[model samples]
Target: MMNIKNYKEVSSLWIEYKSGLKYYILKKIKNEDLADELSHEVLMKIYKSCCSGNEIKNIRSWMYQIAHNTVIDHLKKENKFADEVTEILGVDKNNTYEDVEEFVEPLIKLLPEKYSAPLILSDIKGINQIEVSKKMNLSLTATKSRIQRARKLLKEKIIECSNLEINAKGNPISIEIKADCEPLQKNSRKNN
Candidate 1:
């Protein structure tokens, strides 16, 4: 636990808070160094906000709100160079060696944009649900629904991807997932 009263404790809490933030960002961003940089950006802003004499009511939530903005800011910055992100998204920019990037790229494609936004923002970026709601400009309940839908989609996609990988391996895994996703499969690949 961290308190506002103790500077060292606050700083320690800041570091811990940041690791989780970085995890979230890394999941969606799919780049460790980029995610770490974004996490640092959020924490630095929080520190500066404190130094600027803004009264934070709930330190944890307040920090997350800032994290949300940092993510939004990062997105906005990316948006300024729209062609770049679009290209980045479409490409398999897996530098060095990591299966996570290869696997996640396909999974990301399976998710709907709206559902993906909240899901990625909350689950991947480690932003709080409330902060995600705010970022998506959705009511909290709506955000919950989007997240649930995203999970459903992600589960379905992963299972599908797994089956594909297995089938490729000439393994004898049951093909039940294909039958289960029959209706979803019709439009699953279509980006809505």
Candidate 2:
């Protein structure tokens, strides 16, 4: 039921898609290594789905959906990897910046699909918010709201991280201070 000609055509199409996907994903991810890694994931999923005869009638739409999900999943996996890496690096989990940035990455994965694009485009790339809105075919207000929420979330994460560090230090100080008072009480007992 399969033709060699059709397979060859699909292979060529996949190659073309890969180049575009690399640049597109790279722009959004901000890290060369990460974009390359996620692009590889997107390509693999597309190739596998197409070969499996998944009835993808709209190739563009189907490919975009797959790429989007692949990127989100990649983000989640990267966050986990970062956390593990921080631990392996002997960074203190309770008062470390390592897990803070890494943990926030996965939260971006939770943003609405509609918001993800504009936020990544405008915030990550320093593109004008209005320009990103036009590119996404979204209203300027919606684009601004997404960016605002993203900033707010990051701010909260930083504050939470600072609080964690402070709390971790607080317990140790309280214990040390209590221990210091015990020595003073022992000296008073001797004087008595």
Candidate 3:
């Protein structure tokens, strides 16, 4: 339970940080309404954690970390929701991308960090390649090359581990796991 002093502190902190937090989220999300909503959510999370009696050593850092994670969670959920809507509406006939993504996600983890990190930031998280290059501290050319190589490696791994049925458009229609494919089996088990 929050004591009077702690409650006052939390309220004061909210007043001090709300606008800054909202701006931080807006920069990442590019939406005013969502930034306001997520900022309020951050305040509530701070209040709850404070009420639960966790001693936060650095309140500012903790608050910003929460705000950062909230933005990331929103982005991921937004992407997934769009995909779900597309599937539900039958807007895209080539909806097998999501199905393939399920199998590919684990395979990405098996890749080397250098290769996988670039691929994940650019492709999975949907960050712009230039932004990914900046984040990864790599030249744009290097980032693009790594992404291309990662795709090739992922394609090879998929082919090695499963038999993919392709349609006339060269899209994968179905994937059948090969017998005794230990890497994928282990990855699947680990994920589960």
lDDT value, residue 123 of candidate 3: 88
Candidate 3 residue runs with Cα over 4 Å from true position: 1-96, 187-192
Order of candidate numbers by TM-score, starting with the best: 3, 1, 2
Worst 10 residues of 1 by lDDT: 91-100
Per-model TM-score on C-alpha atoms: 0.37, 0.36, 0.49
| CA deviation > 4 Å runs, candidate 1 | 1-9, 80-192
- Each candidate's number of clashing pairs is 3, 0, 0
Scored against the true structure, residue 90 in model 1 reaches a CA lDDT of 41
Evaluated against the true structure, the overall lDDT of model 2 is: 0.54
Question: Candidate 2 on 1-192: residue-level lDDT in tens?
Answer: 232234565677677677766665665466899878888788777556555643433354345445555655665666757554334334222212333344344445445666566767876677998899888887889889888887776555434333222222231110001223343334335545
Q: What is the lDDT for 142 in model 1?
A: 97
Name the 10 consecutive residues with the lowest summed lDDT in model 2: 171-180
- Sequence-dependent TM-score of model 3: 0.49
